[model samples]
Target: MSARWRLAPGERAVWLTATTLFLLVTAAWLEHQITWYLAVDQFGYLTFAHDLLAGRVYHEWAPFQWLARTIPPRTDALAQAYVYDHGRLYCRYSPGFPILLASWIGLLGDDAAHYLNLTLFLVLLSVLIAVQWRLLRSRWRALAGTVPIVVLPTSVYLWALTPTREVAAHLSAFTGLFLLLRAGGRGLAPWRTAIAGVALGYAASVRPDAILYLVPATLLVAVHLRRRRSPFGVVARIGVVGAIGVVVGLLPALAYNWTATGNPFRSTQGMELDQFLAPLPRSEPTPAGGAVGYPSPGWHGGTTSDVQGGGLRLANLPRTLPANLAFLIEAYTPALLAAVVWGGVVALMVRPLVFVTAVPYGIVALLLYSCWPRPDPRYLIGVNLLLPMLLVEGTVGTLDLVRRLAWRGRVEAARRLAFVAAAGMVLALVGAFALRPSTSFGRLAVPILLIAAGGAGMAATWPSRRVVAIVAPLLALTLTGIAVARAWDGLDRRAGFQRPQMLRARDTFRRAVEPRAIVITTEDIGRPAENIEYYSGVAHALYLTDLARWHGSVFGVALLAIQAGVRPYLLLPVSDPERPKILKQLAGVFSLETVRDIPPAQAVEYFVAAPFHRGVHLLLERITWPGFEKEKQGGPPG
Candidate 1:
């Protein structure tokens, strides 16, 4: 009897539930408790979600906004009321992930959104694993295939958080790849092809770079068809499916561009230019010494260079790309590097198809990392997912080849040596697991058992049933256990209330100020920093620097927006170096008052200095220099 059949129904159900619960608990724990500091980009997402809950719609460049806007209304009266009154959402990211978040928030409220996101991520991850199992046709091999993904440190980090566009994009991309492989030369059933196409489209929508995958994927499909000497009908079907997917995926971005910027291809570049470009006025000479202006030119759009002759020039490519790559490597934990090397080595040796699929994605990831100014680790998360799948699949295929040779009696000695080597490798892996920074030595007992099971499977001397019996449950337990343990460790160390202090600060400022607060700050202090519109319940503007004399165009926009009553609260912080000039500019516009210095103990507290708020109130006080005094009843700086 099969092991699956031998297990009691209740026992099987309990096992399945335990595995699932382990994944869920681990994901929740990591997202909520992990000690790794949250990046500013995450705050940007939270702020965007928060703003979507409010009725403000000005910041619509992000694609995630559309998703947030489409959240379904709930039966709960309070949720319904909140949605009806304040849900004018807009986003710069693709609509897929935010839509998912909105749906969860609608169903269970904000408290459950993160957990729901983690659940969705795990479900998709399982689907990818199942796809590999189906392709390999061996349960043991499938389990091995999934191991790298579940245990990779960065993968663990991503699994335990809110859904990012990159996460959705990777899931969609993998699903599309799986469908394509399943449909190869069989000529996909119309509905299946359409569904696959839609999935691919969604992936592309999440990341424009995913568009590169469509061409390669289509060529791969076409190559398979040509090899079969299939009729023109096959070509037509593939073309139609590919075209439909690309168009569907690109539609949201196209529509957004048309509505916002009058060009279908105009991306966040236009919005950034309008909001963060446009030069700042020259700083008047200070009474103390030399005049202070904005620092060296800041980044615009995806380009990391300054605006030249009223447009951004891509001059910093030499300096930017390497820095971005270095940052990307640092952001991913060491496990990722190990996986990449492992995948590369295995791919070169066996299962070349897996290698082919991985290479294009890796190249694309590299290009984006190299060129893009932002060094966000999240951008490369998809690579983490792909490399592990390839590594495991390749390893299993190579082991299977060895087993075939041994069975044929052509290489018995070689097979024996291979088995011994594999056993030693497993022991080493167990030792590595024990040495892992987060894992407890005591908890590694199960992993050691799993390594032994893998060694038994590698030996291939026993009946296949005995091998399956020993290996299947052990592999499952290992994958499930690692996922659970990592999740638990992550949740145990979450920043909790301290992390949400920024949100609280924004709320406080909003309550204290009037409806239209003319907030002014450096460009970096905008959305991710203050999330002013979300927490403050006020319309605000960016202060951009003038490009010719200064590079802080976003800061100038803040001042201009304030002057135009688009902003009402003068929410300037104490960190602006040209605070006197900023104060002088504001003196002409409205009443200037130092409502509050964040640390309270410091005399000349600036907004920038607020982020440096460790236990250094004394240091801040020592460096505090009072310069900007409220111009008593003045209309302009004279």
Candidate 2:
């Protein structure tokens, strides 16, 4: 008889407690690290929430507005505000993340939105761990599956501070996976299956890529039911129940798209149109006459504009699989590659059904992501969650073989020596990552330590399956916490090591905006635009994109009609390598208009220019040239 069949109560409790603590610490540490490192993305989310609360229907001008609708408004005043009035009508992006952000905004204030996102990320991670534990029914396997995720180098690094669509997408994908696994088999209860359906539906809504899992999950369940030879009525009932649950879960997204875009299937068309329209110049050259004219240019082959066409091509293909795989490998850290391969090998052996289910989902995710012009690592975040579970299966299967050999006593010495060697490798890897923060080292080291430690801890208490179960989770959690701490310190140092231009950008935005005056600057001002919009409640005031030129024309006309006295508050010279002539022309024009320079620092000279043609001399007076001496001392803002 296998020794694991027997177990004790005290050993179980210790293991359980340790595992719980480890997960808690790791989750918290990762949350902190990601929040700190990538806080910039939250500005974008907050902008969406701010718009949603105001009730603007459009997703363009602001992407991810769909996520905002999930949260109820916090105040009646906020709820009553018109979306158009708040600048939401012009938003141009998907609404999934915005809807989610909005829900948090309603429950908590705008200030708490990022925290809510972080909390959601942690919750999703916890749920994934719990689900893996339940499905595998092995402590070691579950820990092995979850530890990589908790300490996943990229996952920790990205999660530190950005409340991005990628984060939400990951959460949604995990929820879907959990639901699919929990619903499709003999061990699942009816209620659990229904709940799983709902989760799957919600995941699909957050990221359309998750929809690919539905076909596989449904087929898997249908096959399971068919083999059981249940009555026709039972099958019919299950179908209806699952369908209803899925429809109900999807209703929110369906209704949102239907109301916002006229077609439930289409994303925010307004946003897409805005992106398409914004890229085209106001004027174009007449091919017939060597003369520049209106209607700038139509869409050509480029990264962002080709997304739809790419999606179409991606929808049909076996040839594209290699490209998709390459994209996935490149987007994820090396650790994921090792984990996926190891986990895949193990999953095939231990739970072939899960392996099968995961394969299609991964394939679809890769293909869909590859089709995108921008292949951000965050896009594949959730898809990678399944890897940990696979690793768990692989580790347990290997350990089982080792246990059998140990019992035979024929190769126990060799096994022990191999274990020691593995331990040394893990320690060396971890030490390297701790000393040097390379994504490669971190990814390789974390999983090695986690798998090694988990395997060792389980073996020590094996034959007592209960004890192995308890210790596995604890060890996994401990490793995750250590990785988190390490990640946090590394991120902090990176964020702190900024150039002088970055510092100047931060400081310039802080002082530029006053109560009601609009602050106009060139687009692509990097962190400065974010700072101005965030610090100053002046979203309309700071025009950073090319869209600002259009807005400026309108403002210029209004100023001319109203005879409203406009003055130059601050002007920062925009440096561009590709368009040096344009930059020079802009500078000469500003100087001709008598724009003054305000010296902020030795690095950046701030200029004050008024609205041209409306009180042109007052615009000149507002613009002070800190003189040629100041210009000579400080080069343009980089």
Candidate 3:
């Protein structure tokens, strides 16, 4: 607390700026509640967090059960379902994020757990910003000029709220970078390197992919050592110490995986393997008295819980790369390419060491993501965070360049010219804002104007090369305002599209069934099952593939339900081409009938508006199993 007050005004502003952004995000959350942005990964994390709190490491069954009066809709339809290991069920995800989130959930309760999770993140983020703030002030006081840039781009705020491990990854990676930069300047003490390594390793624990950050750091160190003509023994010793720290940090994850899946290297997400390319289906036998006939053979595929036979292949990478690249660039439009361009320039001119240490990681990240089968924007978040730092460095480098040029003569002429150019740019942006057609473009225009104002102000004050001090905060405020507007709009959009449908579905389900009744459905993904199980103690839910030995069939779902001493009920697409065959297959084995019609809840529709929404509306609507009966009848469908 004392240390906080000791901060200089600019440093304190950094803290306050982060705190303000955090508050705005939290306010959005309070208004939207936990259901907003409910992805499958989040359900797993929340469920796993609960499991951890309850003293269980592996979940053999779904955890929720409630009187069938109602069940919340699981919004994360694509989240991975539980995987079977030699007949035992366990979550197929890395446990790092959940393990960290568990203590917070226990402390805050289910409803407020997310708020607490994010609040804790704010505290950590503030610290990270403070450290970086101090570092920037020391190395380049001109960096204060770029302080406003911390408002970040709008996408960043959106990502911060999502359930994915990226936020934790960002935190860990940033903290590690801060530590590493500090260690680099402070004589690279053994403990400092080890701690930085450990911090990076923790980032990996949160999201395994973060280990890539170390690749550049290591290269940078080697280059620095080479440049300094360090002894081989010293380099070897440093490498060994760092390696030991990373391993020690990663041990918990390794042990957790080995215990859960018998393979420490195998992440439950199974993302490395193309999920869409699963093995060919083969006939297998079902359990005795099982409605269908054979036990389903488990196989790893893409991220989906249901067995899938096809997907975007590696050959598709060439085609996918362009759109992904465009989206990636658009996503980081806030910082522009200042970090990327200037970061390189600054490294070459001021700190060649940073180029050696951190730039390679960015390069590797680019290559790795570009080649990835699926090009999700979330994967590049860490790189986005790094971009601003680069931008700051670049801004400072520009100032230094100007100072050098000024010393060579012609200072007054350059200053006058800069002022004229800056004023012209400001006028152009204001004119463009007035002429903008759409609200989206209009939203961006305001920030563009602010950026121009920063430039103009810097020019007017001429001879002051540190434009960052003038531009950074103004730009930060501009982006922050835009981010706030987007957050509200995004939250509202989510509520309009998914929230109502989900609440209605849950209410419908509660009214449709009695308490303690088992639900057997084709929708066996983690989110649905977890939601049902959370509300109801009967965690017995199975995917269609969970029943038959053959892949991609709903036949086995009925069989498993029968064997569990409960009548089977399925939630399936009524109009699907496979529906007729599926019903025929169950004809003599179990009676089938529609309990209720679940209207279309395609997430795409909500996001895409009007005509586009209709495209998927026809495809995703589903129907449930027959009405619940107190007693099971041995007869076929009537």
Q: For residues 1-638, what per-residue lDDT tens digits would candidate 2 score against the true structure?
A: 23442236775675567566655665555444432111234455566666677786543432113212322231111111112323334222345677788888898875565566567766766776666655565554555566566455434334534555655755665565565554223444456557767766766666555566676567656755766776787777777777777766666567666765467776542232233323223443222111010001221112222121222333223434554455445433344455466656655665566566565666666666654333334545656666656645444444554555566674555367337534643565555555634554455455555655666555644532333354455445555556556545554433221233334543554454333333444322222234444544432223223222222232332223122322333333433232344235335323323234333232221221111111111111122233332454586632
Error of 3 at 243 (Å): 1.7
Per-model TM against the reference: 0.66, 0.65, 0.71
| Candidate 1 similarity to native, TM-score | 0.66
Native-vs-model 2 lDDT? 0.47
Give candidate 3's whole-model lDDT.
0.50
Per-residue CA lDDT of candidate 3, range 63-83, in tens?
A: 122211121122112124445
Cα deviation in Å at residue 480, candidate 1? 2.5
Q: Tell me how many clashing residue pairs each candidate has.
A: 51, 49, 33
Residue 250 lDDT (model 3): 77
- Residue 271, candidate 1: Cα error in Å is 10
Residue-level lDDT of model 1, residues 194-264, one tens digit each, is 66677777776666667656654665566557666778976787678767876776776667545434577
lDDT of 1: 0.46
Off by over 4 Å in 1: 1-15, 30-116, 138-150, 159-163, 181-187, 219-229, 261-356, 373-375, 394-397, 413-473, 497-507, 523-530, 539-576, 580-591, 600-638
Better of 2 and 3 by lDDT: 3
